[model samples]
Target: MMSAVVVAARAWIGTPYLHQASCKGAGADCLGLLRGVWREVVGAEPEAVPAYSPDWSEPARREDLAAAAGRWLSAESAMAPGVVLLFRMREAAVAKHMGILSVAGDAPKFVHAYSGHGVVESPLSLPWERRVVGLFRFPGH
Candidate 1:
């Protein structure tokens, strides 16, 4: 199941970044990428996502994304392939970015739809690790 999640995420590589969109090979933001993968691997979304802006939850200092993940995904502590990672871009900011872990071990990596780079695999380097605030697994996985 974990490998299947990784495969589904990798299939979204090269998708253009589009805020609020979730179509593979067309466009997707970080959340959209996750949503796309969920549709492929986990069946329909559990709930509808409300419209959001780029500066989501920042002004209000709310962890909207993390809250949603908590409701629908199983929280986990250990890092492993297929886990969803939520990151805080900066100190004192709400976690808003997310990715699916694709590779674990020495050269750990993750797949995400970066704003400028679109969907791509990135090294889970120290910098990225430091930003991770929450880890989760797909429901029933």
Candidate 2:
């Protein structure tokens, strides 16, 4: 199952970054990447996602992403492959970025769709590590 998750996530690589989009090899945002993977590996999505702005819920100071993850995903402490990583872009801001773990060893990597970069695998460097506020696993995984 974990391998399937990783495979699904990797398949999204090269997808163009597009806000509020979630089609593989087409366009997707960070959350959209995860949504695409979820559809591929976990059947249908549990619920519909409302439209969101680029700033997300930051202006409202709401942890909307984290709250949804808690409701639909299983929280985990281990930083293993295929885990869902929720990041706090800033100390005082809501966690708006997310990715699926692709590598968990020394040179850890994750797949996410960034503003300038499409869905790409990035090394889990110190800067990225410092922003991780929560880790989770797909439900039933």
Candidate 3:
């Protein structure tokens, strides 16, 4: 399953960054990338996502994405490779970013889509670790 995730995520490497979009060989946001991966590894998305703005949770002061993830995915206590990660950019902000843990080791790593960088694998450094608010696994795996 972990290998399946790495294979699927690596295929998104060059996709352009697009807010709220999820299309391989084109554009996708962090969540979009996860959605695409779900389609490949699990099945169709569990639910249709409502349209959302880039700042969807900023003003609401809600962890909408985390809540939604919890509803669909099973949380994992250990940082296992291929588990999904939800991050909060700030202590007060809602959890927003999502990624797949590709390497869970001293030099941990994950794959995600960012505005300027598109899709890329990043080190799960202190800065990134501090932002992690939730951890989940693909269902039925």
Whole-model Cα lDDT per candidate?
0.94, 0.93, 0.89
- Give the range where candidate 3 is weakest over 10 consecutive residues by summed lDDT: 1-10
Ranking of predictions according to lDDT: 1, 2, 3
**How does model 2 fare in lDDT?**
0.93
Q: Which stretches of candidate 1 lie over 4 Å from their true place?
A: none
Residue pairs with colliding backbones in model 3 are none
Off by over 4 Å in 2: none
- Model 3, position 92, has a per-residue lDDT of 82
How many clashing residue pairs, candidate 1? 0
Per-residue lDDT of candidate 2, residues 16-53 (tens digit): 99999999988999999989988988889999999999
lDDT (tens digit, per residue) of candidate 1 on 8-90: 99999999999999999899999999999999989999999999999998998889999999999999998899999999999
Clashes of each: 0, 0, 0
Provide the TM-score for each candidate, comma-separated.
Answer: 0.97, 0.97, 0.95
TM-score quality measure for candidate 2: 0.97
Tens-digit lDDT string for candidate 3 (1-141): 457887899889889999988999799999999999999999888899989888877888877898899999998888978889899988888888999899988999999998899989989999999999888988865
